[model samples]
Target: MYALLQSTAVAPNSLTVIDFLADFVKFWQIIVFVFGAYQFWANRRERLAADKVREAQELLDSNYQAWLVVNSAQGKGGSGGRIDALTNLARNAQSLAGVNVDGAWLVGVDLRGADLAHASFKDANLQGALLSGANLKHANLEGANLSAAQLEGTMLQGARVSGARFSAASLLRADLADLVGWREIAAVNYARLQEIQRAPHGFREWAVEQGAEGNAVSEDMSAENFSTQFRAV
Candidate 1:
């Protein structure tokens, strides 16, 4: 205690004072540095958030403009614009529900997982197009060519496919027959579960033989009543 009092009793020397001042300066420098770093990080986060919102809004604006082109680009000499807009919408996975593009040439367009509910593609050429996992509920595909198209897991429950040939196309696990508008509507889900269209080769053949039908399942066939009624359910 006496030694400590002797060291601190009098004012410290110039060296001691300089050392204390240096430590004080370093402590505040660290505080200032930490505060500045936090501000920088916070500012960076705000900028990133703003950029994300801006990008989303820009995308929505683009889709809206494309939709405008799709609706207006009809009648004659408008297929080019319509096709481009449709392609953009499809690429963006936008809904094409109830949008009519009759007789448009959209061969090889990529429409995977697109929402095409109630869309009219009558006489549209979609040969070799990618339509896997697409929603085609109540869509009109009369006279549309879907040759070599991919329809794996596609929902086609109420799509009107009259004159639409799925020749060489894939229909793996696709949704079908809900458009039949059956009295037993609950059975529709079960029917979709055991889709005869997606049957094993042997099972399909056996069912065909049991039904005494030909190998070809016509698009005009009513799968519900096992009749030859085409168009609406």
Candidate 2:
């Protein structure tokens, strides 16, 4: 009779131990689930915070410079967090035209298809920048370093290119339809271009005179400041 009583006591202890183990596992699972939810919510909030429209609206109610607003909560930062801010500014469709962005350090910036019409990029470091299909009409690009920049299909109609470097830059089919004087100063070394015959009148003859291999080439790194930016594209 005593042994049966001991056996019953041991059975209850075993059940209690099992219950404790189950509770411990449940507690840890709850912690893990809470942590995961927190992470997801944090990431979602970050993306929402980078919205250009929201920032624009906020600007109306706050005191901030348009340039300072370019920095996106800054994870995808460029040289000195300028990339994030510049990108946001470029994407925002609010009267960017005629804004003076002269001498901006925008190296390797991906501004494809942004409406940069009439914006002054004079003397800017645009090396290896992706500006394809972007509107640069009537913009001032004087003395800009566009080496290896992808300007394919960019609208450069009436834009100024005085002393601009196009070394190894891709200007294939760029809308230089109204640009003047590029043939005199544009450095087209290894640059991609339309067939000389298909190019705007006089571009092909100019390419052959410059001794390019089926393309226009110029060895003039005018002012020796133009450096090659080994672009992958």
Candidate 3:
């Protein structure tokens, strides 16, 4: 091979070899870099799109829950039949916004993973309802009864809970940051309990003498105090 190379002088110049190698390496490096950038940009775009979809789904779920509560309250009697009706009604009401279903007797209803944003549930009866992981943003629950309700991991942001009864409700790990009038209700409940515990010996008689109903518990206690009265008797 050496004799043939020396005869033909086939060995390329060193400068030519170096230039060819350098250009080849530079071209390959540019190709790799371009592909890497494309892959990075595509992945980033997909992640952003997924996040937007998740956010929209959450909002839709919240509104759907509010509609279910309204229909359950209006449709009365027939037990199983009413529940079937409610199932259909909820499917339909999901198309609308800001549902109003108040004064309904909803004991032990399972509303987990529901969305209840901007719903009006004034004076609703929701004793023992399971509302875990539910979204209740901007919902109006004024004078509603939520006694013993499971509110674990529930989102109650921007909710109006004025006069709402949560006497025995579980709020563990629930989001109450945007709840309106939460502090006021807590103070009111505390005051009512203090008044009952510190009542004078003749307070009952004095209340009656002053035209206050002797049997009346505090104003906030009217809905829940019936059991208290029964226990006292």
lDDT of model 1 at position 166:
52
Query: Candidate 2: where is the Cα deviation over 4 Å?
Result: 1-66, 69-81, 92-95, 195-200, 211-233
Clashes of each: 1, 2, 4
Model 2, 79-98: lDDT tens digits are 55455555655666444567
Candidate 1, which ten residues in sequence have the lowest lDDT sum? 184-193
Question: Each model's TM-score, in the order given?
Answer: 0.68, 0.57, 0.44
Clashing pairs in 3: 61-115, 62-115, 62-116, 70-101
lDDT, candidate 3, equals 0.58
Q: By lDDT, highest first, what's the ranking?
A: 2, 1, 3
lDDT of 1 at 116: 91
Question: What do the candidate models score in CA lDDT, each in turn?
Answer: 0.65, 0.68, 0.58
Please tell me which predicted candidate would have the highest TM-score against the true structure: 1
lDDT per residue (tens digit) for residues 58-173 in model 3 = 75765556445445545342233333333344444442236555665556566676666787667776666667777777888887777656676777777888777765454555
Q: CA shift at 134, candidate 2, in angstroms?
A: 0.1
